[model samples]
Target chain A: MASKFETPQVRKFPIIPKLENSATSHLSPFKSKEEFQSSLGYPGELVENWQEKAIDKMGDLLGKYRSLRVYLDSCIQCGACTDKCHYYQGTKDPNNMPVGRQNLMRSVYRRYFTLPGKYFPKLVGAKDLTKEVLDDWYSYYHQCSQCRRCAVFCPIGIDTAEISMAAREVMDSIGVGQKYCNEIIGKVHKIGNNLGLPEPALADTLEGLEEDVLDDTEIDVKFPLDVKDSEVLLVTPSADFFAEPHVDGLIGYAKVFHQAGISWTLSSHASEAANFGMFIGSYDNMKKLAMRIREAALELNVKRIVFGECGHAWRVAYSFLNTLAGPFDFLDPRYPVPQHICEITNGLIDQNVLNFDKSANDDMTLTYHDSCNVARASSMGGIMGGQFTIPRKIIQTVANNFYDMDDETIKEKTYCCGGGGGLLTDDLMELRVKGALPRMEALKHLIEEKGVTHMAAICAICKSQFSKVFQYYDLELDQIVSLHQLVSNALIMNKKEV
Target chain B: MSFVTILYAAMFYFAAAILFIGLAYRVYEYAKIPAPLKIPTPPAPMTQKGVAIRIFREVVFFESLFSATKWTWLFSWIFHLALLLAAFRHLKYFTDPVWFWVSFELVQVAGHYAAYLMLAGLLGLLARRVFVDRVRYISSPSDYLILVLIIAIAGSGLMMKWFPSDILAIKLFFVGLLTFNFSELPSDVVLLIHLSLVIALMIIFPYSKLLHAPGLFFSPTRNQVDNARSKRHVANWAKRMESTK
Candidate 1:
């Protein structure tokens, strides 16, 4: 289907686009309906005293989160982060610029919370919390993917993600929640996962997966669900249970587990690893979601908890899990509380437990797209930049030809997949396609220069996003492959016992 | 004491009070609020010592800014380094027995020339705010005025070298203020203008974006240690929520 919005032309060399005033001002996500809003404990709709409530929420968040308070106060308007955002680069809307998006709420913050802004608002660029300003917050703040690429470049480490998240939180508190994030969060609360897959349905999906693997690999690689006394509890995103390319990665996890001879089971209780609560900046909801995993781990008596392939899921698992639902003194203390699947696969590859037939992936020359959250927000193997190396190591072991994209576009400087931090819904398809411009340009460069056909990603969002966006850029949809799907292809599941 | 002496002394005292007290309050608020999550921008250091080194590199070298854009880093670094040197040189006036380093010939010569570099840095910053479309779009009136204010201060200070002021009386006046002894301040127009702008910067330091200096130390993204997995980080507010669970 042709995109309703114009797709940004892939540039040969990336240049900062000229600022267009309100270029994407009309692209706000659908607001949460009454049921969706209240299910997450927010008001049903725009509250009667939303203005006062929003300012009060802002004041409360400023006190509660040091990141929100310090970041709002610390921006020097230096523009180091201006061209750093994919949204800004694609849309050319000044408001999509990290500083511009921040100034939306920062202006309000100054007006209500600072002394000078209280007296001389215009001089300091502070504005009253008017309807127009609040609308700008909703439209522009959603445009941000909370990627933190801007933070890596900021002089004072002023994270625009923190600002946008707080803006979202303040909006939700005043009954102005976005439908996509709020509804997903509500599903995770009521049902076990974002897709609202019930326990029996989850088991049925796993069973179908087991049969599919048996039909292909002719091995009894078990995709266990709710099996007590298992050695490991695998809490993957619900999308992995059914979505294309993601489900293949799930099969790869089963194959690896079978080969390594480590027993693992999925939890019907804490079925989701992608916590939308973090996207909305609700600590309460985030902790509640995190605690479900903790409860599952304790109830199943698992020795280790390993998260599957998801970007922000791994971030929450790697970074915030311990803080949110920790002292997992109950689980084995030797392992990291929640380890990443790539770390496990890489470890097995190092130990020579899982042998790979490198020629199995010889049909395509491959490149890796570092998902923004996993690359920048979280780490692997308890070492700096391990998140980058560990995944590449796994791919290199499994594939004969593996290449990386542009240096600046890969490691800690990696661009967002345009669908992360809950901006992946179909309603925001235009924003997603436009936001993918920077990443697409880099991928286009590799495809032309290096004969790269497939771009592998560990993030479910990245995979799904690329699958949709590749067609827009005239690349094949199948060009986007799961990192573990490559593993599934190359792994010698039935090696001769020698 | 002449009226100029008492008026300047009172102004100095008030400015000093605002700078210190206001800074303390802002710092206190930052320190009091707990960072509930571990959100260091990676590849961040994994230990406390490594995090200290990370923050030190950020502050002393403007490492992240350098990685971002060379132009911003060059202007900002030169401006900050020159400001520090000039502040160090001013210590000679305030101290009764100037420290050996402050009295050193190299310090005196370098400090005098630091004003030119300071002005150059500020001008470069101001030029960006005006010329760069991205920077100009974000630049508020106060952002421009702050740069201009500092430029004027440095310009007026540099002017005193050619249109000379009473250096000896200025030193004695500052020393007298320190020792609680009233003395006359030379009412040089340039010196008065310079001092007035300096006082204005001090009064606005805590309230303005000037807080980015001390605020950098409190930034959770820069200051946080990347040991969230190994060590469970819990804040007081979060702890209450956990207890209810």
Candidate 2:
């Protein structure tokens, strides 16, 4: 797992290397327990005749999800996506390649479903659903960040992310699930958030945040929780409650809400925005998790809903929430069903309602890293390219020096932070570090050439990922800053009097 | 009626039947499958008209491949475009007096160059699979064989064009077959080989990776609009779940 190739001093595109055997086969996440698996409606253990069950599930999925069937049948192996994956680029493993990873399940799909593969498996590169094949699927599929980078470049739009998701769903149905995602999902079901920070702890955290904001500025900005009849219910990731930089972003949201005189409260029932069900590819689980927001909104009678900084969460909310828990007729129809906090702040900025003393961020030169989910899965301002522009617009408005990385590495072409798609656990540390190579290389270029002292990201996962993986490249952990943290630093609270 | 003509007429009919029926079944399967969620790669088009234009650009221009790697795109585009021209030009054999468009001098000239380009493009693509480390690693035997098969078909066709085989007999044979009358077929070795290879490609089209032709149109991630928030997209099974709830 060591850096097999020379670390490029500046960011460059990943070149195809000679394929190595077992480059990452040793990497696998801890398996979930029986209770954890059953909690999410999966089997307690590997079921009897799991092969048949897995194949049946694959067939069920093929019927239920059109993307799976199309993608499975469509690949011509032209290798357009061969070098598109960050893990393959970093690991030099053919299995990490998008097509290679997909074939882990695609091969079995071929064997059981296609006539040629059923008759002549070896000729078609198809294999039976053996235990070894299942283990490989678990390993390689987890390595993918579900970023859809390869899907963008594929001629037929064969998304490996869809294949990975289907494979995970199949595994879970067979009583094989990743401990990190399944356990977190169980926590969300039992308690309200992944952290299991109960109502008292959440109240305690908000109290500390409110005191901190007042200590910094004379104005007492409120961080309300479970307050009924609030105009807006803010749903943010639990990491923002405790983690540095993320916590600063949380405080920034509070100040923005205070300055705008908007009554917003966080729902303890739906305290966290991150949805691990999306990572594990379970629609039932994802929908169950998403339904909490709708329930909380109706119960609290909030007119609107606004989501905080979380990558995949925003994707689920922006792209899947309406279908999962819809008919939000009780809420305000004037706003976007669930507006992104960036859009809210940007709207306020556009209205000249919020003031920023840009010089407050003079200590830093910054570049924005677009989270994969936000960059590719959802948009802001209901326009194309809004996702890419809205965050950078906010950053430039708040900070003095903002330079973008190479065009190829930004916007829709952005690399995953490597810790996404539920691979953020310590069990997959090597994959996380190596997978961070592409984005890290981009950051290194900005640091050396553009005087980019810090990189701001909207997602909590990207912030946590860069903070941990920066050490491997001899970069400081503090180099990863939150976009709202920058906004927090620059906002002039006393501007209303001026 | 010659024995060779009868044999070829029957072969073409069988191959065409398999190709059409098989492709139709596969396409129906793809179309019937429910897309439970909205997952279009963004910045996706918002309207149905926009998505159609997007797919048209992808099919005609290979836009995604053009952005991915210029080398693959160049070879793939040349092969596909030239293949289209070469196939269209060959329509003269099945039509009596030929379609008016095929009679154009420009079309005739383009067809000749297209055949040459097709051969050149196939060879370049085959070379990439052979030499490129990443491509070579992922290439199965069928992948390489598919390329070799196409190269053979193109090579044989080019030989007949350059050597001036019994074109009148070949055209009469195809035209007679279409009209349910048999004619003496060309016994020229190159023409026979070319016809056999073309028949094989058609028979194998639906069963093999050639399904990508239809699969591209059905791909949900590429074809769906990025308007999940504005309009709810619930699949049939998802609707059933709601009803049960």
Candidate 3:
């Protein structure tokens, strides 16, 4: 026998499967290529022979190639990352392995982008871009959640998630994106948010929520809709108005505002906060999605804008909001001074504006889950929200057993909930579960070993992912609640609970 | 011993110290990313039982390479193992009695094989970098310098062993350099080249990405526990609700 492993290797990875979707399909499983092109602000059709697009534009394409090549060429394939992947850890498949995952993207990228392709293609294991390779690209790229957990272990400072994102961008450009992502983008274009709920319905929902709050607590909270000349325009993910954990989070927001007595309105036009453009990797879609919030805010003439506790929403708001929205007439140059709800709570806490009856949130050991997008991608730069101490301060008063996971479990290198991007849709459940294994495995230890009773989260999708994990592993879903709900549960407001 | 030897040795030693110190500091800094940003996993799954097998397959068997292109893996595996063994076997410098053990005999044999592997691997690696157009573009002057330094170290060390140079004097020079002193290398041109190259690699290891040796573990992605699901990732509003209610 030549070797024993080779036989198994053949049986392991089957030949590349044929592609299901094509370039000509309408309403592309991703948005139709034309719609996608429109979003990218590109004039021509989505790149057909994308390899040709690399011609004469070495600067841009080369920039991507350099990022990929640097990452791949530097990695030693040490398998230091075999068990490190959330997916790999969840399902010990070699294919789900991070190094192999990166190699899939990098090897292909190298074949097309690098100079060796022109001569020694086979030497580099590069081949023609057949339909099979395209299918492989889609399956493997989608398999990745772009959580960046794998990037943390990459030896040469490589980032596989960046590679996956870039691949998704390329796929979206080529009209090969997933249905959930594309359909959501279409919804954002048509109805101002991916959920496809219109302004009237959103207004109706908010009104109902206000009524419910008054009925339950006897508090007169104004669910502001299209209020012109308001000082602040507050926006949140649609999940806040509808979903379980996040709905309570919205209640807490209203409570904070009621206590602070700040003038704010929720624009019925642009209340949704989830941005699918980030998933598909289109700047145009990203801009268009963000622009909806801006136009709605401007139409209502709000002085400031505050984003709810969604991770990527605040990221877009903080990073690209100013550039995309533009020079507004009434904007304070600092047009939308984006503020996190925690910072808002922390402000109240710091100023002693709010009182707490901590016993109301009793019988649970609560710990904080730093949503990866918010902590690593955005904040890690400065203090409070610019890298704040506020979240920790807020967590202290919430529950008793505030045990940390481990030294490496807390910051900078936090793992994503695999459902990031548009993967939270029910269609990608298996992948999400598989990808969530690492985080769940860690949580399992905390619950069993570290006495972690309640898992506190800020993002809506994080709630979604955590709930699924809780159910899958038969852990407590009710044990998971947003920090806002916990705060609202125990908020020592001067008025009585109605 | 000439002044040039002493001066060159001093510069090499200083460069090596700077490289080691800089590399250690950089790795520590990378390791210190704040808590909220951490993506911690439960624990390493690649523990002693399973990892020993994996390490053997990767390091001892080079099994991955057997499937890898013949030229590529053959050359690479040979080079890496050789270098590894030689480095480990070289404990003879510090511990004189190291040569007497059974493991030492195996190491000596492994050492010879490693020397051969080193020269061949270096040639193959360098040739691939030079001739392969893609690798060529990524390759820089510093990359080539490190490769050349490695070759020089191997080549000169081989000369000392095979030609039987007065190793005591040469080892004394290295010891002196280690102890904040420098003397002329007590050997001829081949040995001189080896001594200088060893010192040069130590110096260059820090500034270049080659320092990825330790940098890998410090990577937050690999070492961290994926405890994202366990903690209450509450928003500011939630915190207020929890505290106030």
Candidate 4:
């Protein structure tokens, strides 16, 4: 589907645009149909008493999630985070601002729950839960990627991501579901992966990948599936099996395992590392998805679990997995119960066991884009800022030339790929293009000044999103490469002595 | 007691009750709610002591805000620090014999001058709220009014320096209110207006955005330690789901 909206022009330097009301109001994604919603255990359409149901859901979430409750009350309108959101910067929509988006729900929270808003709504800027307010919530909440960048800047640590998640959860409860997220979540529940790839298809895809690796490197690298008693169970996003640059990353993971001589297998039961449950703010759904990994680990008797390159998926796996589905005391306790592939590869690099042919990646100058979730919401190697460092350490060791983008744009303050938090569908192509502006400006400057050739990222969404949005900025689609894709290029594989 | 004294005394008690009780309830709610996940914003502290230091920096230095925008940080830090000093200086009214530190020559001098800095900071913040396009867009009526209310309180309190209210009588009235004994409050117009505004602020503190003071400490993103993988963190409500599984 072609976008009716114009792509926001990338500026020389990223500057905060003036306030524009309702700028992205008409940019909402397609709503989930009855089947999609019902599959997720939500109503088929808008509930008859959606207003009351939404309010009740909000109250329930306020009691349940501490982030939502404290964040709603903590914002002092200090505007520290006013210019921190990528959507706001790109779209120039006031409602896209973290605080502006939060206020849409905050106003309703005040009206129904707080004293001042209850008696004096106008004075506090609280509003009644009318059709227009709900519409605004549907439109603006989807705009936020739940990136958590604003929380880093906020004086009180009031995360708009938390509020946006809660808002999404409330919408889901009221039979108002986003087609992209809800549909993906339902597919995960039904088919064990976001792509809905059944057991035989997943095995066939792995077999094909094995033959491709053999054809290229002439190494009998195996992509085993459901292999019992494997030492490691490799869980990755379904896109890794289907999409470009992403599938290349999956091949990289396979090659690493092949070199390290570690027994690893992909489970057909829990094939996806990307948990859309977190995007919808459904605890039950999130836990259900996580439990699949736990069950797969137990069923296969894998001693360790390693997650592949996915941004939000890493956050769920690293931060929420322990709480959601844990007591992994059943597995080996020597390593982090659920480790990242980067952690594994970095560990092997530290041990000096993996050799690299750095000249293989000399064709391009590379810089890494710190995917938002991995940078701010998750960690690697049990160290502070390890997520940013470990990936770069790998790139430098495996490749010849490397440069970082602007200091502010690279680390904890990294921009979202614009397609995260379940807004990656084609209907939202315009938003994805505009939201890529901040990142594109920095990347373009690096390319022109430093003579950079390719930008590598660890996230599946970042890979896909940049591949699509790069064309609009006059950059080549191939400029976006996977972190492990670089690794695959430079990795020196030793052939089996058969 | 005269009607003026009685009315003012009643208002003070009422405002104080709301301030303390309402704040206590809010704090209790915050404390009781379980943070189901470890969501400390990274590069976060890995240890409990490290988390303590992180929160300390956030509270004392406005560390996050400082990194975000220097102007907002400057105004906000100035206002908050000055407000602390001014609040400490006002404690002399309630203390029968002021604590030695409160009356220390440097503190007494600095505390008296803090009022000016506080006013300046408030004005800077107010100007941003009214002038900055992004800030102005997010500001509600109450946001501006909250600043105006505090400015008025500070202004009238400063006015007493020129108008010369009976300080001894005012102190006695506050002390009387603290105790069971009742006394007449000096009815200086500036003093009366200042006290009334102070009372209004106290009444609205918990119900208003001022809850940010306590809310900051309770924020999971700032207060949580980054050891999610090392230990299992399950809340009571979430634990129920585990049992069912």
Candidate 5:
């Protein structure tokens, strides 16, 4: 099984350094640019030299000291991930290839930032800064939807999406960020969400949506906000107030909570979980925006935080909340636990408090589209496995047809909807549509060969991207619906509660 | 200095310095790109388990490169391999004896054929850049300029090898210069051309994308992994909810 021609080994790190408190005491456990380089024997003087030139270097220093540095020092670029990314599969342009995309920002970042870099530039293929390279950085970094699907395929877990985010952040630090990414981040800072919708405007939008639900279903449903002493604080993406398929998912979350009799209220101060700041690699911005949600929850005295179906927001909730803002006491030790809508539905089912009639969606065969963020980068997926249990269970209870996509189409290997990392922007629609090819190719196969009629998605972004892909690919529009949409349609809600 | 030595030294100092110096500048420029360092950097390609498979696909088999363009790969492979051989063979001057006995055979063959191949490859790459609209569109002044200088270096090197010249004396003159002991030198026109081209390469080495060779190791793409879950495992507002400390 082994061919003889082999490459030399990289110098292995000795446990001695990690064990020696005298030398390694300063090393942080998590990945940090400063720690990784310091471990790599990079002299800190290189950074100090640059700091001397620039008076306003504190922010840059802290940013570099954070986990970003570890991410910067570790990529080897074996190109094994080429076939793993749905974007690459969709658009076969070598530029879109994950490794090539990572290199677009990475190679240049190394020369200016690392130690051996200052001495041996050519040995590493580092080039000097130019306006042209910056331009290329923007074009390619944005080209990444930040879908972590490729991460699922990496051997050592190199996440190309992280590279794209870091590239955008570096550009933003240098005042070179895209109008789209930076503007959204600014709005998230100034207002509550990327749309810059204030509390009054947000209330009006939700009240308007409640009225729409009443008109459609003849049921009076209120979307509550900023109520004190609630057991749960629910946060939804700002997109839900205006966006279509996402609105249905939001409605689905509301109904699931309503049916379960959970005391929850939305917080206008922290209305959205779609932290676009994350996409730009601004950890401070992400923390600032996310902290507001924490503040609202603490002030509201909620027992738990139920996050609506938003991708990156969920990622932040699941991945970063504990580390940056941790050891919560005001919250029930178990309180402030963020739950996916499916999790709530699944919880209701497990408690035997929910009933279902699958006949409503029986006309079509349903296939689930796993959102890239939830599937790869977060643990909420197990909840999906739990929550999605009900729709099928209800379908079986009512004798409806249910099927699945290809083996690779489910779980961690799920294809991205091609609009992740906020490519749903009008400016990026062409790129999004182009990048959707690989995922669509797989979906098209299911639609045509496997007789898949409806694609059930849990995340709002997936619903949005799938709808666009369905439209472009000339598939049925109604076929793409959120799991909640199906739940609302098929749930056996008590007539008295309605 | 003899006319040949002076002319060769003058030209090589100019050409090699321009080429290599410009390249160094380019490398530095690449490092200055506005990119954050949060992305993960992986280990050396040689360190990974599937490295052999990857090397086969990437370097030897030319899988993706072949798909990009057959001719680009052809020129690139020939240029890289010949340049590597030339560099290794030049090690003959650095040590008492050449350490790469295996590669020495390839270097001997290169001494015979690398000059013409490099000229052809560089010219082919240069022409392809000019004639092919796509490559031309991406090709910068430095990219084309680097190719021209490389052609000159290989050509001068081949010319010296084929022609009977006091190359040892010329080599010693360069050694003395490197040791900071510049003195009288042998008269050789071709050696001067090669030296100038080599010098030109050194000065410009820091300014280009070629710096990516080192930058790649520092790049987050090779290092960072998708560990968002490890960070996000806690519920929102857990601090406020708990806040015991």
Candidate 6:
């Protein structure tokens, strides 16, 4: 859906002035269908006493996560995080400000849990949990991409992502789940991936990819599926099987594996890497989905697991996989139990195992968009700042011309793709476009100043987002390419076979 | 002791009890609650030593705030540093023989200037809330009220400092309270107002956002190491779930 507000043209990415309630408060995603909600073991519909249930969930959460409890109590409202949110920067909605969005629940929290809010609600800005308040929670929490950019700047380290996740979890407990997240989570539960592509369909897609690779390179290449006794299990996003430039990334992964001569297989059982449970902030769901990869690894007897290019998926796989589904003692200890493709690629490059004809990608001048989750949540190569380096190192090795966007927007302080944190659904398209404004502005400057023609991203969500949102900012759709797409182009296949 | 002395003594005891007990409970709750995952915002340090260094820089220098916005960093650091010095100066009243540092004239002079600096910093913060659009939008009455309360406390304390009070009597009053012996409080208007505001601040410190004093240490984002892959950190509840599995 086109943004209802006037979209700004690209020129130094226009800073939106505060318009005092500029963003309409009522813009919300469609509710989850009853079947979708129940599939994840949540209530099938809004419970009889949803308010009480929601409050009970909040209480349960407060007891569980120290981050939630302390963050609720710790905010001094010093306003360091006020302008940090991309949604707030784009929409100028006061409610979108990290603190303002947090206050939606904090106000209600104060009313019920704190003495001042109980005795002097008006003085403390506390309010009861009304239907309108719940509506506000749904609308605003969805607007957040859970990027954690605000947390980096917050003096007290209050993460708005934590608050937003907690809010979504509370909403789900009351049967008010978002259709995008909960539905995909259900797909992940039943089918192996988010697309709900059944086993036969997944096998067909992989076979088609192999045929395409052979046709292009004129050499023998394999995309093995569910092959037991493989050395590595490649758990990648299902989008890589269907969507471009994501599929191009998948081809790149295949080439890297081929060049390195590593025996790797994709499992039809755990065919997906993107975990939607993280988006909805459900630990049980997250853990349940993570268990699939472990199952797939054991069933296939694979020694190592490697995640392909998806932003938040890498975060879950890198940061939480061991905790959720671990003790992967069966896997090869020579490598990390789960390694990022970039890290593996970087390692191969370091060892001179792969070769790239840099001139092959000479047509495109490129810059990299550091996907928020990968930039801020996950690392590469067991080092600090490897997340920033590994992908860039891969790009520079394969691509001739490369320029970074603004230094501020490149590293740990990177902006979200506006479509992350499960806001990738078509229903939240308006919010996505607006949220993308900051990153797009940085990209615009790179295009103008450095003549950069393409922006390569590692995350599937980021690639899809930039492809869609670029048109709004007067940039062509093809300007967004997968980081591995660059690698695929420059990858020189075995001349002897050809 | 007169009726006023007894009432003042009771007020001090009440405020002290609330402040200590409330803070104790909040901090206890924070310590007891488990962080279920390792979510240190990257590019965070990977080692425990690195995390300690990071937190030390965050606390002592306000490094994150400095990088985010210099104006905020300046104002907040000024207020915090000055408040720390002023609080240190007040140690003279509680200690049997004032600590050597507090007894020094140099430190006393710094404490004197700190009150004025604290007031200026509070005003700058208050003005930002009034003018900065984004910050203004997020400002609630309590946000403004908290600043105003601290400002009043500093302002009243300055008045007593500028126009001298019955220092011996006030010191004796605090010492008496500390040692559990009742004593008559000084009969100075500015001193009384300052004491009342200080008491009010102490009572509200635990309930209000002042909990940030303790909460920052417990914040997982700031305090956690970036070694999630190397070490699997599952909370107690999560481990229990794993057991069932």
RMSD of 5: 14.7
All candidates' TM-scores? 0.99, 0.97, 0.65, 0.99, 0.60, 0.98
Q: What is the number of residue pairs that collide in model 6? A: 0
lDDT of 4 by residue, A1-498 (tens): 644777787778777899888888988889999999998889988999999999999989888889899999989999999998999889999999999999999999999999899999999999999999989999999999999999999999988888988999999888999999998888988899999999999999999998998899999989999999999999999999979889999999989998999999999999999999988888988999999999999999999999999999999999998888888988899989799999999999999879999999999999999999999999999999899899999999999999999988989999998999998889988888888889998999999899999999999999999999999999999999988888899998888622
- Compare the candidates by lDDT and give the number of the best one: 4
| Per-candidate RMSD, Å | 1.4, 2.1, 13.3, 1.1, 14.7, 1.5
Report candidate 5's fraction of native contacts: 0.08
Q: What is the lDDT of residue A497 in candidate 5?
A: 60
TM (chain A) per model: 0.98, 0.97, 0.84, 0.99, 0.81, 0.98
Write down the C-alpha DockQ for each prediction.
0.90, 0.81, 0.05, 0.90, 0.05, 0.80
Error of 5 at A162 (Å): 2.2
Superposed Cα deviation of residue A32, candidate 5 (Å): 28
Q: What is candidate 1's local distance difference test score? A: 0.91
Task: Please list the C-alpha lDDT of all candidates, in the order they appear.
Answer: 0.91, 0.89, 0.60, 0.92, 0.59, 0.88
* CA deviation > 4 Å runs, candidate 5: A1-74, A113-123, A215-218, A381-399, B1-245
Superposition error at B27 for model 3 (Å):
23
Tens-digit lDDT track for model 1 on B104-210? 88888888889999999999999989999999999999999999999999999999987788888999999998899878899988899999999899999999999
In candidate 2 chain B, what residue range of length 10 has the lowest lDDT sum?
A: B236-245
Off by over 4 Å in 2: A1-14, A495-498, B162-165, B243-245
C-alpha lDDT (0 to 100) for residue B26 of candidate 1: 89
lDDT of 1 by residue, A1-498 (tens): 224788999999988899999989988898899999998889988889899999999989898999888888888998888899999988999999899999999899899999999999999999999999989999998999999999999999999889889999999999899998999889988988999999999999999998998888778788899889998999898889989889989999988888888999999999999999999999988988999999999899999999999999998999999999988888888888899899889888888899889999999899998999998889998889999999998889999998899998999999999988889988888889999999999999998999999999999889889889888999999898888899999999864322
Where is model 5 chain A poorest over a 10-residue stretch in terms of lDDT? A14-23
Q: Tell me the tens digit of each residue's lDDT in model 2 across A1-498.
A: 233433323235545667887888988998999999999999988999999999999999999998999888889988899888988878878999998898888789889999878888887788999999989998999899999999999999998889999999999999999999999999999998999999999999899988888788877889999999999999999999999679989988988898888999999999989998889889999988998888899889899999999999899989998899886778788888889999999999999999999999999999999999999888999888899999999999999999999788899999999999999988888888888888888888788888889999999999888899888888898988888899889988863422
Please provide, for model 6 over A110-213, each residue's C-alpha lDDT reduced to its tens digit, 9 standing for 90 to 100.
99899999999998889999998999999999898889998988988899888899999999998998998998889888888999999998889888988888
Model 5, residue A18: distance off in Å is: 45
- At residue A413, what lDDT does model 5 achieve? 65
Q: Write the per-residue lDDT of candidate 5 for residues A256-276, one digit (tens) a residue.
A: 677777878998888878877
